[model samples]
Target: MKRKGKRKMLIAIIILLVVVVVGLGGALFFTAGERREARNLPIGHVNFKQLHDGTYLGKYEGGMYKWRANKVQVTVSSSKVTDIKLIEHTEKQPTGITDELFSRVIQSQSLQVDTISGATLTSKAYLKAIEEALEVAQE
Candidate 1:
């Protein structure tokens, strides 16, 4: 009788562990899917000529779970993207990414620039925010 009881308890513990592991795995899979989706988000072509001269604020709500959400203040002057300021971001220090990416955008005067290596998703999110700010400037 004692052996049977112990066996039953052991089986229950094993089942519980399996269920926990499976649940955690499923959650991670879904979250990863969303993260990947954010990376693939399309960046639209922005015509600098159409943008008005002003500072506009914009934001990308990141992915489904907002892990990469960010905001930017884009300055347009003389029909050019003069500057891009990182107002808010998820990174502890996004200076490097923003410096490189924003300079590329300013130099090109477009949002179709290549994303920074190793920070593709972050680049896209920031670009999206800049796009939004430009869209507002156009209006």
Candidate 2:
């Protein structure tokens, strides 16, 4: 009877350990996935023609989305970007080039400017937000 009780207790302990290990492994995988998604998001698919001419507002949400979040208010008339106002940008890791290129785009009405070295994605995201705002203005 004593031997049987000990075997049952050992089996129960093994099961609990396995469950704990599996849960931890699953959590780690999800965390890693979320991190990768924020760091490697594609920001180059923005279409320019979608932007309409006129003043518009934009907003960028924080968190993992911050990697992709950028907002700007742009005024476009006759296909020219007369003004660009950055509303809220939470670019935590993007390069300083975003700001430099942003000024160029506002003055040029074209995102054809060069990408900020090391901050290419952030630059794209800022343009995307500006583009998105202009697009909204068209409607």
Candidate 3:
């Protein structure tokens, strides 16, 4: 009787552990999917030409679970994007990813550039920051 009781308890504990592990895994998967969806959302365009020729500070916090740029400085000169500086960011990717995105923005003088393939969330956040900064320039 004692042996049977111990076995039953052990089985119950194992089942509970499995349920907890599966639940946590499901939660993580759902959160990751939500973040991916947020990353894929449209990055609004900003017409650099409409912005004044000056430096502007922009900041954007991505949706829950997404990467974010806490602060960005966008410099506009002669109705063009002259520089993009990431002042603060929460991206874990290397700096090269940021540089590539900044280069695209400067080259196109617009926010409608393609996102970095592997760092889509960071790219979107950077673009959103630039757009917000340009919006400030317009005011």
Candidate 4:
């Protein structure tokens, strides 16, 4: 009787472990897909010359899982991107992308600026939002 009880307990523990492992694997797979989609997001060209002086709001609806969703307020002055403010983000922690990175966009007068290291996906999402705001300024 004692041996049977031990065997049942061991089996239950094994099943719980398997369930946990499978759940983790599924979550990882989903996250990997989301990251891949974000990494491949296209950053289109924004013509500063066409943008009128104005403040515009833009948003990225996030990719597959909406994990990186963000919004920005972009200011265009004299047909140039004068400033970019991060209004909101879904990231769990700050990704070190801030004024300096936005400064690059303003300085370049383009959305093709280099992304922040180790924050490529977040950078792209923000850039895309910026591009959208610029597009609105164009109209």
TM-score top scorer: 4
lDDT of each: 0.89, 0.65, 0.82, 0.87
lDDT of 4 by residue, 1-139 (tens): 9999999999999999999999999988879988999889999987788989889999999898888898999988887888899999887646356676798898888888899888889888888889889889998
Candidate 3: stretches off by over 4 Å? 1-24, 33-37
TM of each candidate vs. truth: 0.77, 0.53, 0.75, 0.79
List model 2 lDDT by residue over 16-105, tens digit each. Answer: 999999999998886775456544644443344555566787654533535457677777777666777666666665334655777788
- Sequence-dependent TM-score of model 3: 0.75
Q: Report the lDDT tens digits of candidate 1 across residue range 1-139.
A: 9999999999999999999999999998888887778867999877788989989999999888887889999988998889899988876645887899999999988899999998888888899999999998998
Candidate 4 residues lying further than 4 Å off, grouped into runs, are 1-24, 93-95
Give per-residue CA lDDT, model 3, range 1-139, as digits (tens).
9999999999999999999999999988878875776667676766556888889999887667545646899888887789989898776778899899999988887888889998777778778888889998877
| Residue pairs of candidate 4 with colliding backbone atoms | none
Q: Order of all candidates by lDDT, from best down to worst?
A: 1, 4, 3, 2
* TM-score for predicted model 2 compared with the true structure: 0.53
Scored against the true structure, residue 66 in model 4 reaches a CA lDDT of 87
Q: What is the lDDT of residue 114 in candidate 3?
A: 86
